[model samples]
Target: MPVTPDRWNDLERLFGPRGACSGCWCMWYRIKRSEWSSNANAGNRRAFKQIVDSGGTPGLLAYVHDQPSGWVSVAPREDFSSLERSNVLKRVDDKPVWSIVCFFVSKEHRRQGLSQALLEAAVKYAAEHGATLVEGYPVDRLEGKKFSSVEAFPGSVASFRRAGFREAARRSPTRPIMRRRVRPRPKG
Candidate 1:
């Protein structure tokens, strides 16, 4: 389900007091670094809530047994200014695309293929909204190597692959830009 005003409580419960990582509130890419630093915690939470309350579907919420389990931030590429500023993650092309920038799954829900499911759902959600292409920047891990959950918050390359996304660019050793084409929903 998309994060809306009615589901604000569920989102808050899932993010907890820390705001899903040191007060990030999943606003890291939506604002400038200086602004994000100043808005950490309560400020960030309030800002995110404003987006939800204003009827913005900033992301999707995954539910498990009627409880919020995970979140994936997907939006038009322009919505994330930070991406345009990052040399490493800059636009792969001029083509319009929806970007998947973040993911957070409850500890208990980790490693259960929830991330992949969220990726798939996000693609469908974007397509429904008229996006023909969806992109993701996921961490590429070497075989048999392990990393902290925080490092995987953007997602793992394996998960993107499982979702039928193909590598579109690799400007960094461990970060790869992946893409998937979707047939947008037909208009009436």
Candidate 2:
């Protein structure tokens, strides 16, 4: 199961003291740029915590046994302004979609396919939540070189493909808006 209220601690532990890369606490996409900068470390954490307290589940957490190993933020595409407002990431159509906005895994848990696991869960989340379509804006990974953690928040193209999403549009050279239509399973 995905992380719930009682498992909030796992999410906190995964973020660590620095708020999972320079005090972002994964709020980089949620808040306005100026506000994000001003709030810094503690600010983002508070913002994310408030969202959780209000029972607005922003994403899913992966645990290896008991500890939080990774996180992925998936919600209605419009919920992430940083992407919605971006010239590079414009809407493909008027169709509504749930967006997989970000991913964060503890340094110790990096490269363990947790991002993929979280994405799989995200698809399920979207499908169960009445989203007929799930979308993602992911980066194309080059061989050998690694991107800054901040830059990698959108996840890699390979990961999205691995989770059964296909490219819907590619306007940017390095970024692509991929999508998967989550058809409801037939109930007997």
The predictions' CA RMSDs to the true structure, in order, are 1.5, 2.2
Q: Per-residue CA lDDT of candidate 1, range 1-188, in tens?
A: 88999999999999999999989998999999999999879999998999898888999999999999999999999988999898879999999999999999999999898888889889999999999999999999987889888888899998899899999999998998999999999533
lDDT by residue (1-188, candidate 2, tens digit) is 55567777888888888887889877887878999999989888898888888788888888787777888888887777787677778788999899988899878878888888888888988888888999998998767778887789889999999888999998888899999999754322
Instruction: Report the Cα lDDT for residue 111, model 1.
Output: 88
Residue runs of model 1 more than 4 Å from their true location after superposition: 186-188
Clash count, candidate 1:
0
Instruction: Give the lDDT of residue 50 in candidate 2.
Output: 86
lDDT of each: 0.92, 0.84
- lDDT winner among the candidates? 1
Q: After superposition, how far is residue 148 of candidate 1 from its true place, in Å?
A: 1.0
lDDT of 1 at 3: 93
TM-score of each: 0.96, 0.91
Listed per model in order, the count of residue pairs whose N, CA or C atoms clash below 3 Å is: 0, 0
Name the candidate that leads on TM-score. Answer: 1
Which pairs clash in model 1? none
